[model samples]
Target: MLKIEGLSKTFGKGTLNEKKIFSNFNFNVDNGDFITIIGSNGAGKSSLFNAIFGTFLPDEGRIYLDNKDITYVPSHVRAKDIGYLFQDPRVGTAPNMTIEENLFLAAGEGGWFSIGQKKKSNEFKEKLSLLNMNLENNLKKPVGLLSGGQRQALTLLMATYSKPKLLLLDEHTAALDPETAKKVLDLTNKVVKEEHLTCLMITHSMESALSHGNRIIMMNDGQIIYDAKGKEKEEQTVQGLLNLFKTKEGNLMASDRMLLEV
Candidate 1:
């Protein structure tokens, strides 16, 4: 349901600090297609999401969602159909607000997820209980008091409160503990399957990239070097992906591949 064509971007152009982040990077996702993106730092993975979300304008490119020209739609309007979860959970919520208040914002003012129409009562509490988290007992508590895992879980719920057409997860589990990260990842898989949400997640975990999404895109030097799906992807290994990256660029760094928690 989303399409990116010839998306390109650069930082510090026209000077010694000039760097080209994207060079005709193109990608697309069908409805209900959970695509996982993998690449090293500065692979233009996050930049691609920003361009698609309208947070940054591509120097020259176009993005379309379900055939509509969203290249210049601006972030607020784009938020109606897209959800973004950054590496930091704090980026998604108002830390000073109580859990209840934060969720109220997620329910939105008049948007699809808005809770303004309903009195903030037992109903919201009931929904929070479904998370199987004790959050239901602490609606009045400031979110800052919660652990990183709890915050990230709540953030995931808030992101999907309105059921956006596309979900962008930028290293959402990178900051959590191994156990917590697995928990969040499990919740993520559940949410995507249950909602049939079209998602694009950038992860350093090779196992996660292969095992979770229906398709995987491997990017290098701003271009998609590898793309595979279903049965083809089931045969992949972390070392295999590393070898491919090395074969293309002749080396792989310790920073590129994730350590298997097992």
Candidate 2:
């Protein structure tokens, strides 16, 4: 459903600290595809998401969603069709707002007039109950008062409330504890499948990359070193992926965080 052609981006151009992120990059994401992306530091994984979501205009290339070019679309405009979840749970939510208020905004009903409406409140409670986090009874509690996992779960629900065409998850569970992360990931899978949404997730865990998505892509130096799906992806193992990276890049991945976390 998304196509990126001849994409390129660079930062600090023409200066001593210049860095080139992408050069003539091309990628295509099929509809309903859940793609897991893994790469070392400076591999442009998050940059790819930023480019697609219009966080910054690419120096060159065209980005198309559903056959319509959106290369120059402003980030705010793209926000209507794209849902992005950051690693930090605090990034997308209003800390001081009550849980109900936040959901009220995400649901896009109207304004404060729509906040306590019985019908809308009931719907929000029903959705919250599905989270099984006892959040339905905490509607009046400030989001900042919730635990990290709880806040992240709430953010996930808010992002998907309107069903965007694509969801971008940038190491969304990287900040949580193991058990909490698992819970969040399980909820993520459930939501994506039930909504039939296309998704791209950047993760540090090799096991997560292999197990969670239908397709797995390994990137390095701003290029896709490996792309596998279906039977090929299912057959890949963590050790095999490490060997492939060593063969292609002449060494194991250089990121300490990636190595340690996986």
Candidate 3:
């Protein structure tokens, strides 16, 4: 469960380039809710995640997770309860490290130190096996040698190994080919359901937003312009969502990436 109230963020404040991103933005996410977020470029989708992840302090307002305030909590402190997968696969992994080594570090989150002796545990192997990518046999292989999809899958596994309270997916599959993206998305869905994790995913594809999550949110000009859930979300088609965006914002959806994905 996450709640944000009166959240405001601005960059280059009081200068010629002063541009406000969020103006009293407010949102609430329920426990175990899988929410897909969509918007054109500069809709503040990534900024919203950055604020929640404590990448920087917001100018005002508060954030709470499971009823505990974490607005000003440092990113390292929040890392234990939050799992983040970046759009770039390389960003989330240590390229020089072996696959098992990376996973060992992930599993040891919130710990002061990790014992190298435990890297070969059956638990680790079992988890790797679930990927169905034959990564279990390549534990000693460097992560840099993996394909894009394989590395992303490993990152997903590492991120969820501890079953954090929330998972933040920032276009995690956008870098892959269509088929590979679908595989990764399927794996993501499987893991999220198995863990019953609360998730917030930012995606450019209208089809992805409508197809994956139980809830869909549209952002425009730094505010949530539309939010749909349950039957409303289930009944939505890509064309209908595009029409809704046009109706709400009185402008055509203008992202080439989003348009092409649909």
Candidate 4:
């Protein structure tokens, strides 16, 4: 479970370029809750994740995971409980490293000195097999040589290998072609379900936001403008969400990427 209380963040504060991103933003995520987040550009979606991950300190507020405050915790410390997948496949992986090697580092976060101590273990192979991407057979292959879809699939496996308390997916499938994106999304859904992981995924597709998670949230300006769950969320459609956004923001939705993708 996670709770964000009265969170606030600003950029270029106390200067001519001062811009507030979050003004007393508040949100709570329940245990094993899979939440998909959607918002226009500058909706504070990335800022929210950055604040939660300790990429930067929030101006004011507290973030609690399973009742422990982690607002100011160092990113590396938080990495133990949080697994993040970036939009760019190249970001989360060591390109020069073999697929199995990258996973070894992920499984042993603080054991970097033991990097060369082990090769691909049966357990690692077993996990890769679940992806159905045939990566298990190429464990020794360099990650950089794989296709974007393949690399992203490997990154997802590495990120979830330890079953962290929370998984942050920052449009992890956005970079792939439509077919590859669908495959990656399917793999993501499978992994999340099998692990029963609490997840927060930011997506640019209304169809993706509505189709994947049990809960859907819409962000606007600096705060959560709409939150839907259970049957409410199940009943939602892409058109309905777009209409809701227009109603709440009193302006046309601005993200051309989202519109075109949907």
TM-score of 2: 0.97
1-262, model 2: which lDDT tens digit per residue? Answer: 9999999988899999899999999999999999999988878899999999998889999999999999999999999899999999888889999999999888876775754578888899999999988999999999999999999999999999999999999999999999999999999999999999999999989888888879999988899999999999999998888888888878774563473365
How well does each candidate superpose onto the true structure, as a TM-score?
0.92, 0.97, 0.94, 0.94
Of 1 and 2, which scores higher on lDDT?
2
Best by TM-score: 2
Poorest 10 consecutive residues by lDDT, candidate 2: 253-262
- The segments of candidate 2 whose C-alpha lies over 4 angstroms from its true place after superposition are 253-262
**Decoy 3 TM-score against native:** 0.94
Candidate 3 lDDT, 166-213, residue by residue in tens? 999999999999999998999999999999999999998999889897
Candidate 4 segments exceeding 4 Å error = 109-120
By lDDT, the better pick of 1 and 3 is: 3
lDDT of 4 by residue, 7-47 (tens): 88888989999999987888999999999999888888888
Candidate number of the best lDDT: 2
Cand. 4 TM to true fold: 0.94
Backbone steric clashes in candidate 1, count: 2
For model 1, the local distance difference test gives 0.85
N/CA/C clash count, model 4: 0
Model 1: residues >4 Å from true position, as ranges?
110-120, 257-262
Model 1: per-residue lDDT, tens digit, 1-262?
8998988788888999998988787888999999888888777788778888999888888899999989889899999899999988778888888898888788774442355435554666877776766888999899998888889889999999889999999999999888889988988999899988999999877778988989999887788999999888889887788788889877776666553322
Which residues of candidate 3, in runs, are more than 4 Å off?
109-120, 253-257, 260-262
Note the Cα lDDT for every prediction shown.
0.85, 0.91, 0.89, 0.88
lDDT of 1 at 158: 90
